[model samples]
Each structure stands twice: as C-alpha cells, then as structure tokens.
Target: MSNVTRYLCAAAYLDSGFRDKVLAELLFDQFRAIPPSYGGFDLMPVIYHCRRSRMMLVVRDALITGFFVIGCFMAPLSTFGWLWTLVPFALLTVDGIRRGPLIVRALIWFWACYSVFSLIFLAIMTALIPAAAYLFASGLPFSGLYGSGSTGSVLQQFLIPVVTLGIALVYRIAIYLTLVGSLKPGAPEPIIATTHPRLARRLDYIRRAQWGNVTMYANEDAFMGAGRIQRNWSIAVELDRVRESHKPSRRADPVDIDPVELHAFVRGRLIEMRDRVLRPNEGIQRLDIGDHVVTRGIFTVADGQRDRAAGAHPMIDRNGLPRFQATAEEIAAIARHPQGGVRYYQRVTINNAGQEIRDLDGNLVAPAEDQEALTSAFIYLAVEGRMLYTQFVVTVLPPAHDHYHVVDSLPTMTSGRVTWEALKVLKLQLLRDVLAAPVRVVRTAVESVRQSAMTPNPRDHIVYPYGARLSVRELGASESLQTHIQVLDVGKYIKMIEQRLTEAVLDFLEERKVETGAYRMQAAGITVSAGNGGTVNVPMAFGEHASATVNGLRPGT
Candidate 1:
C-alpha cells in the first residue's frame, strides 16, 4: 500500500469520514488539486479581491446596483433577463451592508436615502409645475413643464437623478482609497543567514522532554480574578518570534547559538528564579521535613578516604601464606558486599541553620516549623538528554491562630436529654456575654430554681464576674471554647513562585552565547502548590554544554 493509503487506514481507526476523504483524494488526482471555479470562470481571484477590499464592499454593491438599473433599460432581451441581472446585485448589496465597515456602510445608507428623496421630489415637482404654469402664465419657455428640445428643459428634466448618481460615484472612489491604505498584507518572514545544527538539535531535545510544561498557578481563578487580569498560556509558544506581526504558529529559520553563552544564561536564570520567582519562604513551606526527621532522604557525596577504607583487601594467613583457595563466588560476594566494600556516604537532615526552634513556652519545636520558618528548601535536579528536570517535595503545616471562648452551660441543663437543639440554645445564651448579662442571668436562675427543688437565690446568680467569682454547678457542664486560625494567602505565594521559576528559565535563555531571539517570549507554568496533587508544565531552553563541543565548533554545531 502507498504511504497515503497507509496513513488513511491508520486514521480510519479514529475517524471514517476523514479516512474516506483522504482515500478518495489519493485515488483521484483531480480531487487532489481541484481548482475553485463557477460557470467556467475562475472564482479564486474574485474571492481574493473581495477579501482584499472588505472595507470597500459598499462600493461593489453600489456599482452593481447602478449597472443593473442601466442594464434593465438598455437590454433588448425578455423581462426575465433584466430581473436576473438584479439577483447578484441584491446579494452583493446585502453582503456589503452586513460586512462593510461602519463608515462605509454609513456612506452607502446616505446615498440610498438621497436617491429615494430625489425620485420623490421629481414626481412632486412634475405635477406642481404644470398646475403653476396653467394658473400664472400659459405660454412660458417651460409652458408644458419641460418643452421641446431646449437645453434648459433637458437640464430641468434629469437634474435630480444625475446629481444623485454623481454623488454616489464620488463616495465609491473615497471608500476604495480607504481600503487600500488599511488592508495591505504584512511583511514576509526574515531568512536566517547562518545555521547552528547543535543548537537546533538541543532545542528539539528540550521540546521532546516537555520542559515547557511546568506548573505555575495553584488557584488561577483566585489569582487572576483578584488581580483582574486574564491571560492565555498557549500563545506563549509564539513569544520567541522577533516580529510581532507574524502569526503565532509561524516558524523562523534557526540561528547560531554558543555553548558557553547558553550555560551562562541558564546559570543566571537559576539565580534570578531563586531570588525573585520563588519566595524566600515559599519553598521552605514545601520542605519535606517532619517533626524531627527529613521525610525525603538527604543526598550527599561519599568521601574518598571512606571509599578506600571500605574496599576489600586480599586474604592473608599466618606464616606469610596467601589464602588463594577462596571460591570465585566468595570473592565476588566480598567485593560487592551491600555496605562493606561500597563507597562511603553519610545521611543528614536538610536544614539551613543548626539553631533549634522554640515555641512561646520555650519548648523545643518540630523540625518543620510553621509557614514562616519554611523560607528555603533544597532543589533536586535530574538530567535526561538535553533537558534538566527539577523536583522538590514541600511540606506545609497550618498554624494555630484562633481564640478559644469556653462557656459553662451546666446551669441550663435539668433532668432531660441533651439533644442538639438544647445545646444550640445554651450556645446562644453563652454568646450573649456582653449586653444584659445580669438581667438574663437572674431570669434564668429564677426559672431554673422554680423548676428544680434547689433553694438558690436568683439575685445572687452571676453570668459574667468582674471582680468576684460565683460558681454554679448546674451551668458548669456546658463549658466550650472556639479556636480560629489565620488564613494563609497561598495564591500570592503561588504567583511569586511561578514568577521566580519563569524568570529563572528566561535568564537561562538570555545569556550572550545563546543569542536568544525571544524578544517577547513569555514563560508560563502551572503552580503545583497543592499538596502532592499539584501539577505544572514549564517550557525551557538552554544552550549546548561546552564538553559536547568538538574541534572549533560548539556542542550543537
């Protein structure tokens, strides 16, 4: 089977209609290159002309209509021929009215109104002239309204229609000129004079690695809505283009890029991101450290001294005899021992400072402090092909910022069940701690005393004690306190994090060696700041490494 047919069959699995169309086009060469035409005339040029002159569509309609009127009088064919001529004019007029610019449409409407008024005025004048002539003077030059072959009479007869048509023609010319000035196509894309195969190859590798798909926003609605800014990240792919007028998907020729320069760009961007996009405390909030342990293992290099000491030595026996009888398996086992013969390494907690944190009570706090303490964290990186992937596990713990107000409602309870409804009533009574405290306290006390057999004076009851303390055992059972914590603005932190990462990526691309063409490149990423559930995509580009360079050419050369 041909490549086109195979492609069609593969697509058939997804869509039958598309497959059929492709197959048909392949089978019939005529379908592959079908020209657009109507009634033996090519319509493509006409279509292009219309598109190119969209603003002056009104002129086309007016001209067509004027020609139709003239043709209807001049045609020698049947009445039907004259009517048929009106069809295209009618369609053009409707299109021009609907699609033309405001100014053009306005001019068309003015011409139409003037034409109608002229026709009406001509009819009125023709009738009034004869009546006036008969009443005033019977044998004047215009005695019968417009007499016998005189220039004055001829001018009087056709003045309105001629003047109206003249004005319409003048307006059409003005519309044409306006369209030419406004709708010219933009300049063509510039050709790259030089090629950097290494740079191009590296770029392709980065694209395949999906470095651009970084998460940057945690809550877009809250972030964008609060700021009153709306943005689209997909268009970011077009940002690297030097020319703003080009379409978003247009590709430019590859340009030369230097390895040393690209490295500097990447390094600079990493630093910028560290300082600006990622907050001083944002990543700290995401640290993986727990109470006194680093949940994620700490990674460090092994010491050369330890590696040497851990290596296995040849076996020696007494009397200077070498034990050479050991089996190959035993020797191999000794050499690859899980820990004995392995390189030396150590594990330690991931902390910036050795100082311990303390609470207000002077008690030792957890290794992972509150949001404020999480201002910095470690960045883990992995290299695959030409791409670098960064990952970090962040730990966030909500702080206690709420006040507790315990209320004793034991006095309100009697020998009845403590249902949810009864609890709600007692809650309201406790909440009324400010106004009319004494009155409500007294009333409730008396009511309670009457219901029960206890002989306690109602006047002695106290709801809120200022300088004295009064204990009521009945109300003591309803003690409760409300605690609230301050809400952390995670949106702001996410925004900052995204900005820092983007800046880092840009800095990576902006160095001298890389020779970035990203005059307006916009970096975008998802803000995966929500627990282990967050996701983000970030597009990135960095120049070839110096080690990959050969002879005189750069790494990507």
Candidate 2:
C-alpha cells in the first residue's frame, strides 16, 4: 500500500519527466515492449522515434493513474468526478484487453490496482463489510489507507470510496476508444470502392497469411519487401471467388520458347514463355539493340544498315537533265532473266515439340514468286524466318532436295514434334552444279559517341581499325557490319577500342601464311572499280580503309 501510494504521488510530482524516465526504464526491462525494428542502427530517426513512442506510453499511464486517484476524491461530490475516474479505468481495461504492447499494458494493470484498492477500502468501511476481518485479511489497498475502524465506523470512512467508484463507472460508460491496433501496412486491399464493381473481383487478392497472403517472389533484399507486402494482400482476398485466368500463364513450360523461331517472320523479333521482351537501346543516337536480355531480343539485330549511295541512274533526274549510264556493279549484282524479272522463294514453319502437328496445309504457308511453286513450297516445307535469314538463303537453289516429289520452285523444312532422333536421321544432299565464295562474317553492331557540335551528325559511326590504328566513315562502318553503339562518337573512344579487336585478329592471321583458295573479301563500302572504260576511283569509304588493310594485304597475289 505504501509503495503504490508513493508511486502515485511520485508520478504526480515528477509528472512529465518521471513518466518518460519510467517508460525508458520499462522498455529496457521488457524486450517485447519495444516495437519491431528494421535493424538500421545507423538511422538516428528510427531510434529517436522508438524512444519517443515508449515515453508517450509511460507518461499516459502515469497521468491516468494520478487522475484516477483524484477522481476517487471527487466522486463523493459530482458527476464530472466519475468522468475522471471512468476515463482512466476504461483506458487501463482496454489496454489490457486488447493486448497492447506488453510492458505498457502491465503499467496500465498497475493503475487498475489503484482503483481496486480504493474500492476495497470503501467496502471495508461499510457496515455490511467485516472491518476487523478486512484489516486482518490479505492485502493492502491500491490507494493508501489513512486509518482503521469497526464496521459501523468503517461505513463513514468508506463514504469517499463509494462516491469515487460511482463517478468512475459512470464516466467509463460515456466514452470509448475508437481506434487502436496493430499497424499492418501496404497490404493489397480490395478495390471494392471502385466505380466498376466487376473489376474488384479480378484485381483484389485476399490475404490469408498472418502478415499477408500474396506469394512474394524476389532474391534481392529491398525488392523482397514489396513482394512480402503483396503476398500479404494476396492472402487477404477470398481466393475461391477469384475468376480463373482467361489465358494460360506463359511461364508454365520453358521448352515451348525454343520453337518460337519456327513461327516468327524472317527478320522478326520473338518473345518466349517467360513474358520477357526487348527494345532498341535508347543510349545511342541511332536506334540500336542495346540491351541483350535473353528470352527476348534474339531477333533484335537489324538485317542490314541503310544504303546511302547515290543512285547511278534514275527514271528521270530531279535536275532538268536526262540520265542514262547505269552503275555496272549495281546492275551486275542483280540477276535479270529474259523476262526482266526475278523469282524469289519464302517459307515459314512452326515447330511444336511432342505435340501433334495440326495440318495447316497452305494455311500457314507464305511465299513470294511464281504462285504455283510458292504454294507448293509453302505446302511442303517448314516455313521458318531466322533459319532462312541467318542459317540458309531465303531462296532455295538447285540440288537442295525438295521435301517430296520434285517441283519447279523452292523447298523448306518444318518441325512438328522434331526430336533429337529426327534431326540426325535426315541429311538432304545438294547438287554441286552452282556454288560461290562467301564474303563477310557479320560483326556485332557498334555505335559512335560524338557530341553533335563535334561531329555535325551525332549518328556518325566510329570504327576503329587495327591494321591502320584509326577510325573510318559511317557507310564503311555499316559495310563492315559494325555499329557505333553510343550516343556520341568520340575520337578518343575510337582510338582506344579500334586497335583492341584488330591487334588480336591481326596477330592471329599474321601468324598464318596466305593461301589462294577462292577467298571472298568484303570491303568497307570501299572498292577500286574495274570498269571496262578504264576510269576507276577508290571509294569514298577508303580514307582510313587503305590504311586499316595495309598490314594484312599481301604485297602481291
């Protein structure tokens, strides 16, 4: 009794200061009283917040108990006195009932003892209560005892306790706590308030888990937080009510993506079962495939650079002049039949492994050239694009066996449920009548990084030459199939990287002696014309080209 009475008086005397100290002490005494932390001791704000919260709790408890004592004194007189007693009593009861922070609820419990003692003392004072027995009995009052008495005499003494209890009870009836509970944040909530009620059923995920319901997916620490919150909400929603997904999720089977090439158009981009996709690199001035993310962007490379050569002959010159002389090289590159036209073959194939090939006879077929030959090829061969564009010529030639009985046009191959066994079993023979030397091996694309002011054109391509140890023209870069892969084409950058690949390759090729075996050499749009007319010019692309090749070019064939 002495200890509790002194504590109440001490609380009232020290008020704010003592309450804070008590809270600080309580937090240390009980580990669970402290809120959960993110474990960043480096963050002062978090530490301060925790300290402040605990202090507030302690102070609230102290002040409420003090007021409860005062309310006990006032209860004998008026209704307002009950408000004081009831407010603090209800506060303590609710804190305890709700399982508030452990230590805080304990302190509130201690306050309840104060009210109980007041009631016990009043009970002892009433004649109905055995005063001598009460004095001899179990415990001291929560409130202090001033003196002792007989039952009849105790009644007068308890008059004050009786009024205090009534006031406290009445006040508690008038007020109640509206909000106080756990803080579970960022959980996905039902969008029930949305204008389109039908939409909530699709978007809302009920969280059933203790923290949340949604399944979180992440290997990284920071991003995992978002996943955790999402998982919580997913668990919250009523899963039974959610509609089944309209389309099958793409991640079901990864093997299906391998056949994507079979369906994509020649030079077309394709995405796989992962739902991953790609786009041109925005870092460079000229559009380029910068990000090499797998599962997508496999077809992201461009087939060829844009041609910028001056047209040799036009139907009519834009100037008031007639033009006639045809650029012989350009003309020769194109094969014209007596009909003055060309016959091209195109095909597309779809491969579905282990699955029965649906007969899309002619439906999935596409061809260019003679209608009958194209149709037959489409009807027979596997029509695939990347294979045609990269692995084989888009147009089939002689001796490449057609799938079935010979036809006048082209042929291709498709995989229905192609197996490892199926590929090795088949080897189509070729007729050797027509053959040619290969020219160039396409290199990965590069981009220039020259500022606009420095290079007039930001798209100026930069190619570093190992043999010459210098840079060259845009068309030369294109012809070499090299790309300038940055926003600017800086000379220093060109100088630094140009020699990198060259020296490695030159050092290799120089180690081997030259041989004449029908070698095909490609130029950087650079050439010395062998015109029958005898006039020839080194292509404009030859500035650093002649230099770049000096070391590799043999003195005499």
Q: Please report the candidate that would top lDDT against the real structure.
A: 1
TM-score of each: 0.19, 0.15
Which tens-of-lDDT digit does each residue in 1-557 have in candidate 2? Answer: 11111122223212334434433322222111111111111112212323444334334334444444554564433223223233444564343455768787676667656655655554444433454456457475623234444534545444443543333322222111100011111112112243554323211211111122111111222111111111100001111111124322222212111112222222132112112335221111111111100010001111122332243222112321111222433232221211222111112111101112233363433332111110001101121321111111111111111221111111122222222222232211000000000000011011112222242211232321101111111001111111222211222222222232223222322223211111112222122445673322232323354422221122221
**Model 2 ranges with Cα > 4 A deviation:** 1-59, 67-122, 126-220, 227-557
- In model 1, which regions exceed 4 Å deviation? 1-307, 312-378, 381-383, 397-490, 512-557
- Give the C-alpha miss distance for residue 503 in model 1, angstroms: 1.1
Ten-residue stretch with the least lDDT total in model 1 = 466-475
lDDT of 1 by residue, 270-334 (tens): 44433445534333323121111111111122223224333212222121111213343442343
What lDDT does the true structure give each of the candidates? 0.29, 0.23
Cα error, candidate 2, residue 62 (Å): 2.0
